[model samples]
Target: MEKTKYSLGYRNSYVLQQYRCLLSIFTGFIILLFISNTAFALATNPGAVCSNGFSQGSLTNADYTNLVSAVNTNNYVNILGNAGGSIPLQVKMTTVESSTNTVKSNFGVITTAGTSAINIQRTFPNISAYTDIIFDFRNALTSQPIYLTNVALSAFDIDYANSNGNTFDDFVEITGVTQAGSTISGTLQPITGSNIVFGQPPQGLQGLFTRTASDPNCTAKNLGTQCQGSVQFSQPVASVKVRYTNTGYLNSATNQEIDLRVDNYCYVPQYIFTGTVFDDNGGITAAQANATNDDITSSGSIYTNKPNYFNGVFNSPQESGISGSTVKLVNCANTATTYATQIVNTGSPIGQYQFSVPIATFNNNTNICLIEEYSGTAYPIRTTSDNKNTGFTTTTYLYSNNDFGRVIAANAALVLKKAQYINNCPNTLNYTDPSLNTANNGDPKTGFSTGSISNMTPGQCIAYRITATNRANIGINNFVMKDILQKQGVNGATVTSVLTNPPLSTTDYTISENPAIGVNGEIKTKSLTLTSRSKRDFYFNTKYGTTVDTQ
Candidate 1:
């Protein structure tokens, strides 16, 4: 879409003179930004094509004599097109004078050997559609991106299926001679009836598969969205045109360069026989992918609320596509290896992957947990403990890499607001998170409030109101909430008594006091018991009197 610019004429000599210079610079800047953001390109535009529309090259004037001789010498016609047990081997052949689609190179090649075969090498200006397609692939796997180019602009008809009987398309149809050199343009008919092609519907197929935006049979195994391929032409000159394609994920390709060597060209297909030789069986594990380009940065005034997904990204180094994996969201404070889970599927562009949570699992401010969003083959994840270290509060999205790669993960601050309510210390020593709410009901939320473990004086029978929660989407098992007392440190707050297991993932703990409460007071791992499977709560009182008090 073209942006509209308004012209302002002050008609006041003073004001007009003052802002004219500034207006000129501002206009130029706006034009530059518009061009950069839009990245208008002709290669991806469907309207710039010629009369015949991008065509599929066909074989014209087929000389059966040479082909018959080659077939007799080979004798390998036992496989393809085996409809009625056998095909008439000696059938007469005719010439159809197939379209002479000539390619004119855009990346600067004047000619091709003696016969005109364009060797693909180097980068064409990127189609913004390619980047757009990349993002689409990311979000599609996680949910569902463009690269733009102008090579097909006024030169190669973006819509041309025919040329003065010489329209250009995707088929590498070579003519004007034998396989060795050029001569008179040969006329061989497109393979029909008994002739078989890999990607055709077979109903009315009299030729090769012509790539288009709507061709259902357009497919290239292992490429992006296999069946969505489309032919793209880059012809800046008249004599030679180069056509690769939109591999069919909306854009053609980024820089996945392909170089076809002359002597080593081994993928030439022969009619009458076809079979798979090497099938890709392995997956593009996250450890094998490049760093994913998806970021989870806080993007707008309000975060996305649709099935609020916590997207995780990872990279893969291999190219075989991806597989599904699992991530465990475990509570940071729980001593037990308790956690909930979310399934992360393999991404759309093959190697990239996206992980998401329904955004409805977090309950309260006490909901602080740590888990790796990346749940594929390990790139060696890098993350800190979930609120495990001393004085640590911020919930971190673990970003791990197998070999020093990076990925952006959507990390929300898991609110574990802890503050001592009782005025047991100096006024300046007390603190509470001002943003925490008074309560929570465990729906989908962003911020929450949770009271803390506070300071106490010697023999200051302090009542510890502990309400902890694991706010992430996953759940954990057998969480432990421990507290202890020592002689030298600030008097420890004893677990005064048992109350409701508020959060649930923190319940059913066997509250046993060390030495039976004051025979040298210490608590033996106030851990949850066997029955409590997914309790996410913590509640107990404490009498402060010892030098060393901790949880």
Candidate 2:
């Protein structure tokens, strides 16, 4: 009776096999029956898996196949049809200004390698109106730190299938990044399995995802909100302000110079098939050398003499295109075990290239040093100033507090201000400071104050402003004011000096406005008078005019 129930009730097939495995794991067989019932109820009818533009499947492309082939196989694809099928790859360069106001090179590149393949599979079920497609980057080399400088732009052709030809308006145009490479594989892994967390949909995809701006009330106040709406609600003008830690160069040197920027546009997809090999147990089959060899074999021994027999095919123009470029290949093992010089003209016209310090041929060139921004507290992104330190530019970015000298930093500002002062000021009038002090505490007796100056270039203008306090209130009958100018550490006797006259009476200095005076404002010299508390503040101004000769 048990055998009859097992055989008759659940026909032994792939679905049955999975159910039996679930039943075996459960102590109470009743729960297994309930679970199976739920799965069956939730499962869409064979033709109804895709409705209203929703798809559920793995992402990735493990072969070098077009979007059409990938879609028919029921795999995820990023379908991008060429506006015109001339060249599938594109590259562009732009100039961008850095924070220091220096202009540097920015690069952008685009290709229909992986994204189209995934979109094709997603849109295959409806050959009419294409819906939202997912790009699986789980199996991609995303772990590698990529300093992405260029933004990706892409679109699709939905009506291509119905019109029997590609058209501009057939597919919805959406800009995004899939796999950043020349050739894409045909196998894709689900993001859930690959541990990739889904982030907020990009700017352009908000409309497709049915999303509105975060702040409706801020519409009038924010320029970004208005600007974002202008570009199809996708290409926000402030997209440049969007920052992602995951994107851009990782482990970059403190002040490493990235002279060449490469722009990238890519499409990747995954496909499913049924045969002797189970889907879970299958692995990627490499593309053969020729089209004739594009067939499955029991022994898997089909071989074509093409250069890309086992390796992925590079469909780029310009033979041996990237002759001088190089790429580092790594595996999940996290080892720098392999490196390959890029093959030129095999995939893209301007292939990948590596940069290094230009070789020096002249003698005494050892003194010529190159400055690199270093990681440190003073100049967090300041130049490292390299001569022959680390040989490799591939090191990670590191910084410390000691990277910048506080003394140098503090002194730099002073020097700059002094230079500005000298350039803007002229020495034509007289000035005074006394107390026989080179430090310029000021000639209190003479009412002149002068500050010590260093690194003063010849012909540089110097000036001084002096202020006097309590001159009339002081009981001391005699007071002297003097100014001294001399080279630091020089003989004081030889230094030039100036002096002001002594007070003849109690009202030696006059004030237009005094705040220290009391309401009983008699001439109270014996007691605390306004003149006793009176203070003076002076400022110096030396505008360039005719020069004066000091004899």
Q: Pick the candidate with the highest lDDT.
A: 1
Name the regions of candidate 1 deviating beyond 4 angstroms. 1-306, 311-414, 419-457, 484-507, 512-515, 519-537, 546-551
Cα error, residue 177 of model 1, in Å, equals 17
For model 1, what is the C-alpha lDDT against the true structure? 0.26
Q: Report the alpha-carbon TM-score of model 2 versus the true structure.
A: 0.17
Q: Please state the error at residue 282 of candidate 1 in Å.
A: 30
User: Model 2, clash count?
Assistant: 63
- The worst-scoring run of ten residues by lDDT in candidate 1 lies at 131-140
Instruction: List model 1 lDDT by residue over 191-304, tens digit each.
Output: 222111224222222212234534322111111122111222232111111223322322222222211111100011111100111102112223332232112123431222
lDDT of each: 0.26, 0.23
**TM-score (all chains, Cα) for each model:** 0.25, 0.17
